[model samples]
Target chain A: MKSRDLFKKEHSDEQSYVVIHPLDDQPEQKKDLSNFEPMKMTFTVRLSLIILRVYLISMILLLAYHFLNLTGIIKL
Target chain B: MEEKSNKIPDRVDQPSTVIRTRYRWMQKIMLFLVVFGPGLIVMEADNDAGAVSTYTQAGAQYGLHMLWVLLLLLPITYFSQEMVARLGIATGKGHATMIYRRFGKWWGRFSVFDLQLLNFLTLVTEFAGINLATSQMKLSPDITVPLVAVGTIIMVLTASYRRWESITVFLCLLDIAWIIYAIRLGFSFEKITPAAISFFPSGQGITSSYIFLVIAVVGTTIAPWQLFFQQSCVADKRLRFSDLGYARLDTMIGAIFTIIVAGCMMIVGYMAVHSAIGYVYKNPAQMATSLGAYFGTIVKSGLLLLICNASILGITAVSLSSAWAYAEVMNWPTGLELKPKQAIGFYLIYILGVLAAAGLVLIPKAPLQLIIMTVQVLAGIMLPSSMIFLQLLLNDRELLGNEFVNRPWNNWINWTIIIGLFALSIILAVQVVLPQLFSS
Candidate 1:
């Protein structure tokens, strides 16, 4: 009876190990919620944005000068 | 004893088992073949007739002085274009698509409008150039028009992507005719030192006429359409991030080819036209005729044919590029892959552009020369804005990611082009405004 009980206990322990091992091996599954956050506009990005703006302004001014000259409005 | 048994078993298995390789040699060959299209196409297209005419005129009028300018423009072209390739890979979208997404609808609308107008104007020039060349062979515009139109339509429509690319590259190879003409012009291999060290201004006066040509050379070399076209092409081809190195190599090869062709063209003009004991023709066709008079009828006719080929091919390429950009911006069907019916609206615009330009040429009293000059001036005016947009796009981290942003060296080079172009625009504006200012 004692031997039979020990065998039963060992089998139960092995079964439990089998069940828990898979649970442990399976990584925690969490959806990456960080992507759900709105895109943040940082300082470097804003600075780059400003550079583009400046470039546009300069181009506009230069174009205006060309048109004025072509139309004989500006006597440069 | 147990360790020895385990090692013996492992060694025996290793000796018996085969090692599998992940990458095949054939895969490398296929990748190379696929990557081969854009670089050769772009470079060959640069040797188109209008570009040839520009280079010829530059060399004939300025001699070897402006040859240095071509050398200078090389790096600018490579740097600007490589950025486009990166953008394409990073975004998986054309330049126009990215512009729409990042800048909103207003800017998107503006860019489409500008590109379409320019594309139309350029198409007209291309037809004009074709007609001009065919006319030299005594082929009437009537015959030439239908023939060229049908031929181009069939070629683009019937051919698959790989075939279309190959055919275009083959046509581009005919641009080597320029090199042949250069050789005939008697450019000594030993004369490199003299050509390199030569410093003749060759300008009759310190006038704005001279300055305008300088600017024109720069403007023509780094046209705005090239930037949009190249990046979008790279994106369309689905080049991966790893292929960036190969793409950069492609662009460098293209720039080098452009410079070599431009250099040879200048030498041809200098040796043949500038040194000849006769008046130089004002136009490229006229120059060809004069070259025929001096060299041989065969050489002359050959050059003219090559010029026409360049113009026609260039127009077709640029028109298709514009159409692609427009279609992408509006979220319509795009690419040469789409059937004509499916992409009707897209191709209709392109076909209509060709027809309108051809029709304009058929008119009795069209000022073709003025039309050409207007195209150049318009291109000049629009250049600064194009540069501005390109610079913005290059610096955008969200668009390019951290890995692809312009390095300091890249930024410096691009800005130099911008500054140089701006200064030229200013000078040209001044020159036009006060025609008599520098007449003395």
Candidate 2:
């Protein structure tokens, strides 16, 4: 008997049956996506990265300044 | 070789193969039902506890003059979510995994770190909302918080992806109560007709406080956790390329539904403002209390129930986003379809997040207001950066190929939206830090 058929027969019931298709025989356990090449940082990509850093830094500084003022550590 | 079975399974649990339908419309409908859950849940879940507070507050303070903001956000919300769904369908990977791979280690780690931190803080707010809502009903947080925490954990651990999605979708549909409650509170098309298109303030003229409120509405509408949640959800569902059209429709429907629910919450606020009682409450629960005193217990209980529902939905989606993102980056087994043992790290993260947030809410004197402030600031920092990555990924033909890559027009609209979001983020940050600067 075919393995799929035998496995199905064992799990089958009066109301429902498990369909073990070829695709379901060995389900993917875990994915290792480390092998794919990272995107090349072209000038546009590089510039976007630079812009992101600047944006993040400025936001954090603004937050720090606000905290200082809130705590009365800074008058201005 | 065994002949391949041509039977399509309708329900997730039932393993029956049915004959293909003759009618094309029938087939299309079937296909749509299969692709429905993620988009609707994410969008409805967006109207979580914090959203209830923000939208209700907007209506109470400004009336329906701010309805145009929600209308403007409809297209923005749909377009941004459509891209995230497209990426998930195309790449079969979570957002965190995509960032880790495409952006290299430093940026990837930074994105994940920021996402986890913000999501954790947001989860705390969800629990706090739960506590507030339940307290209105004389239910102590000591009992309600732990009960809710355990319930959230059990829902995920015991069910398959399909069953869990069904339960979440049911909760999403329960938002219909908002519309019904608004009607009971005297909402009508006649009242909203003027506010729908009016772009100016009514009660208060455009001040720093007005701008601050506007920014809050925008920030609430388009959150950073949403991107992580929907993408991971799409990937977990294993949607095919053919399902993309249905997924987009699903997202559009979700966006519309969320806006309506949000608008109804605002109506509740608007009614309170117009009422003899007036609008003097701090949060949704308080608003419910004051309104309840006038409108009766039904209104109060209805609002509290809606809050608990929203918080539960938020708790599920937010914690799932954190777990899925963390697992994807760590390359652990992920997906709600897997048994708990098979996805130990993923399930553990979800449980830990719920417990930690609920536990904090239970602490007598925990600075939850401070945490909420920090969440707003971090969300301000996080949203723009996440969008930049999303835009970059969608543009990368090398990653998504021509079929999935953003067209020229898409680039134009998306970039404009991202810049607008960045501006709003800056406004949000400044508002958080220097309240006096934006003080009326």
Comparing only chain B with the true structure, the TM-scores of all models are 0.88, 0.95
Candidate 2 to truth, TM: 0.90
Name the best candidate (by TM-score): 2
Which residue ranges in model 1 land beyond 4 Å of their true spot?
Answer: A1-76, B1-30, B195-199, B202-207, B274-276, B429-440
Worst 10 residues of 2 chain B by lDDT: B1-10
Best by DockQ: 2
TM-score of each: 0.79, 0.90
Candidate 2: tens digits of C-alpha lDDT, residues A41-66? 88878888899999999987887887
Candidate 1 residues B323-364, lDDT tens each? Answer: 778888777876665678878867776676667777787777
Worst 10 residues of 1 chain B by lDDT: B1-10
Listed models, DockQ each: 0.03, 0.17
Write one digit per residue (lDDT tens) for candidate 1, span A1-76. 1111111123322421111111111122212222332223466445644654675565557657766877889866
Q: Flag clash pairs in model 1.
A: none
Tens digits of per-residue lDDT for model 2 on B1-440? 11233343233233453213444465567567777889999999989899999999989877887888899999999999999999987877999999989898898999999999999999999999999999989998899999999999999998488889999999999999999988988877887566453776655457876688789999999999899999999889877565689899999999999999998898888887777354585889988888888889988898899999999999999999999999999999998889999999999999999999999999999999899899999999999999999999999877777788899999999999999999999888887887777776
Find the candidate with the highest lDDT and give its number: 2
